[model samples]
Target: MEIKDLSGMRKDYVSEDFSEKSLLADPYLQFDKWFAEASLVEEFEANAMVLSTSGSDNRPSSRVVLLKKYSKDGFVFFTNYLSRKGREIDENPWCSLLFFWPHRVRQVRVEGVAEKIVYEDSLEYFKSRPVISQASSSLSLQSSILEDKERFDKMIESLVSSGEDIKMPPHWGGYIVKPERFEFWQGGTGRSHDRFRYDLEEDHSWRISRLYP
Candidate 1:
């Protein structure tokens, strides 16, 4: 196969404009409205989001994680506590989450502090997962080097065959991100996108502002 030139690749966004009047006074409610709309389409993983974190060394990393829940309080996702991202969050609680829905020509950026949810919550979600997923989560040590795939597979098989109740690993749980800032972006004609940012005020209200794009 010949390598193709990539310079010409581009798409012009000509979606409807997002205006302040259409925004909810509460940023959380605004997010819910957009998420609800995105959830209606079947093409993409509407709940998938890019979580970015920085450790004490100031080096940053990003990975895609599925958003399990969201509400006025915060956004929630699950992970192994000993994973790289988990360790990074331990060192620095502050992180950012990015969600992009190209089909809708929209994106949401969230900045916040992450805090672990109660263990009971994690257990509840774990129990709701498929048995195979439970086995994988129970057997695999996330972020650790695996020397043998066959061994891992055998372990999972053993767990499945044993017919024992699979429990949530002690190292696995959920984190809730309490957002302090949110930026909502909508693509527009001629590359002129509409952007709005909401910053939490001391008075517990959101101060919304528009940015040139």
Candidate 2:
């Protein structure tokens, strides 16, 4: 085995300036603005975010999940309740969501508590997904070992060809993450980036502060 080093790789970030005065009083509103901007420039899934969760062992795990919905209430994404991330959220509700848009040289960090959304809400989204996707989710035992991916794929194909209506699995649902803190970062020239932190106060108001970057 040989150690590989590619420290020479680098790129400069050039984006519109961001400042405290331009910040929105509500973090959710601020997120909405940035999210909209990212949607315009991102060629791929702009709603994708990294969801990090930890269970009883204190070991952290992160995976990209698409942002299905969001509002002042929280951010929502769906997955199998029996999956590793879902199980972790059940054991420890605290979690974090990170959104990075390289095209915009911006990212947002969200620290929050995750809770399962109502079954009706989950069912609605589940039904809206494409039939193939519905079949896949219904069949997959996410995060579990797959000894035969070919067989699984065949099963999915057969299920779809059968024209059977796929029902949302009992273990599949959505989780809403209520953010307690948010940090918005904008990459700047010469690494003099801009960062701001928003924390929820006792009165349910958000306190915004700038961070040294």
Count clashing pairs, candidate 2: 0
**Model number with the top lDDT:** 2
The candidate scoring highest on TM-score is 2
> In candidate 1, which residue pairs get closer than 3 Å at backbone N, Cα or C atoms, i.e. clash?
none
Off by over 4 Å in 1: 1-5
Q: Which lDDT tens digits does candidate 2 get at residues 96-176?
A: 999999999999999999999999999999999999999999999999999999999999999999998898999999999
lDDT of 1 by residue, 20-119 (tens): 7787888999899899988887387899999999999999999999999998889999998899999999999999999998878999999999999999
State the local distance difference test value for candidate 1: 0.93
Model 2 is weakest, by summed lDDT over 10 consecutive residues, at 15-24
Question: What is each predicted model's overall lDDT from 0 to 1?
Answer: 0.93, 0.95
